[model samples]
Target: MIKEFREALKRFLVEICEFVQERDISFPQRPSGKYQVEVRDGIPSIQPIGIKPKPDLRALDTLMVGLRAWEKETFGNIMEIITRSERLSQAFLTSATGDLISGNRTMVFPKIRPIIEAYFAETNSFDFQQETFNRICDKVEEELRRLPYCSKILQCPVVGIHVSPNCSDCCLQLESDLQVRSLSLEEIEEFLEYPPFLPSFFTTVVEMKKDMEIFKQQLCFPEKDKKRIECVVIALRLLFGDRIFVPFQIERGQGILGKVLLGEQQSYSLEQRVVPPPRLLHIVDQEKYTELKELYHCISETLLERDRAKIAFSDNRSKQRVELALRKWSEGLDQVSAEWKLIAHWIALEGLFSPSSRQELSFRLALRGAIFMEEKEVYQKLKMSYEMRSRIVHGDYSPDDPQLTEIALTTEEILRRILRKILQQPRNYMPDQLEEKLLETLTK
Candidate 1:
């Protein structure tokens, strides 16, 4: 009976993190009252309920009285309890051996008497234990009742880590929808001082509180990273809770097919590159039109080679190359300054010759670009592109920089050349090795 009491007392105290030696205290098998932390209909409640009381034992009745008094004073400090209850439990433990064993030295182990005489110096001291406890419970219930029911979950599959090109190498673009509960970009930076699972050394240049189509960024993950994908999904669910609805479009031709929810919780269709709907060619100038016609076929044949790869790894490898090629191809269409386009072009070209310095990377890509195009002018444009790139980086961009258009076209021409080479070559798409072989062949 004593051992059972000790275990129950130990569980109760440790659950509240107020640990004490259970062996030093004794509990009644039939507790008179209970203070319970109960959950009803998804809401938490700390309720006090009366329990069956044991009869015919005066010492157990004393223990019950002490427990009820302790519950009444629980409104005070979490650590502080009814002082008498502690003394009662201790006294009950000692009563088992009686007062005769105080001076006897046992053969197996020495039984030492407790040094402290009493847990509370004055039991006669009076305090308002019950009244204060009732007030606290009332106030707690009132506040909890006023809170909004959390029936819906609010979660944001927050895309926090954005790695763009070197122009913004150390810079990060914080993206999320602006909402009342959205964690600020600055708050995220402080949180990353001890990141849960991502790198944290990047500098903040511009913070976007909530502007980007945030859900689109999640499409970057593929099936190979399903575990990592789940981790991110779980993290978002935790940070924002269940009301998270990520609505994004899966491109199909020029029109919307319908809407679908995107998350780990539901089944999602794989994103496929769509074929553009048929349209008539309208070229004002017939000369450039024919040139573009041939260029389309050349790129198409290259794409065919890219599509033939059956392996998952190679498919991803080629997908990245094609995406880079398309991005570099489209920069000429962006409504930005020539210097901005130059910067964008240089970044796209980094895949071919990835070195630290922009100048070296530009030169090497230009060398390969020139070799592929069989045009000496591209090499000169490559050199000039680097000089202009530097001016833009240092905030010394000149609007009237000579030959800006020529340089932009030459940059586009080089990206085209790189893509064509990848598709035409029998040897698989290997940019890193291609850079080495090209450098060795050109220099020697």
Candidate 2:
């Protein structure tokens, strides 16, 4: 295997040198000679008097520059792939060179065939055996995680996917069993930002939980360890997608965020003990698994887009556009309600109707889906909520208004249901396209 790998490396190096040589020869020589000016219909055009090879074209320095660029690009690609798995098990990383080398003939070459073909813009020019390639990779994959970091085995991420069906909460759990290994302290700290925890994040408490551990063999786990574990769980949820319900010590506030899983039909909780339940995996019904896969993908994409939108709004340039107003609308979409902010959500949801006027907004929003359209009462309620929005925008309504709470609740629920349905569309849509779809639904 080592010998084969060395030969492949040699071949790669030779090809790289050959590519440079070819490029050096192919560098079209610049048109030579002093410029001669001519007048063409009162416009002056400059032309080269003689065409000759570029004097510096074959210089040693020129060759060196091209070779350096080639090396950087080729080697940079390999390093980029390596960097992606920096948090992977040390054993797997350390063995990467060996694996790549051994698989050079069978695995690496076969896997890279598509890339080579694409670069050449020809597919069948390269012959890669399907069965042989699959077998080679399967073997390596099996051996890849054999020596995972034992002390910290990452478990698959579990997500409580936010769902609303028939205008009711229909949230379900989606557990994807996958794991990652040790990252640097800085990296782990960065991960803590994902959970609902404020000031400090879940993964950030991991070390504190470890310090609380007692017993020689680390048998006795502290009571507070559950929160720390939940922090990791929550971070997993963020890295993946979906709501994660991690039990926190009573001292920590709010078990759920924004009423997530507030009225779940089947809530699963793990006991806080040294040895809790072996696992609480959420298995989708075989019949519904296909839909769950698509739903999960939708949820993941929407959350990612939301994060990007948040980051964009943070930029001062974005704030100067009409988007500044839209940003306010989006803020209320996911933001935890505050006394002063309640009315904003009411106005925000109304704008999703892509209204030509205040009057048309309610009808358009209602027409968006059966959740509101089919429920005539829901449609009326939505219209009423928009009227409340008018009061706030017109300075007639206050957060302290007695009816504000009910109106706020109605708007928030509608926003969640409507947004969830929009996200679940078979294909992804940007905000404008989504608005178009809302109108298209009414016509259809």
TM-score of each: 0.30, 0.31
Clashing residue pairs, candidate 2?
Answer: 156-177, 156-178
TM-score of 1: 0.30
Give each model's clash number.
Answer: 7, 2
The TM-score of candidate 2 is 0.31
Query: Candidate 1: where are CA atoms >4 Å away?
Result: 1-319, 355-359, 372-376, 426-430, 433-444
Candidate 2 regions off by >4 Å? 1-295, 303-351, 356-359, 366-372, 423-444
lDDT digits (tens) for residues 250-303 of candidate 1: 111100100111111213233132212112211113343233233333343333
Local lDDT at 251 for model 1: 16
lDDT of each: 0.36, 0.35
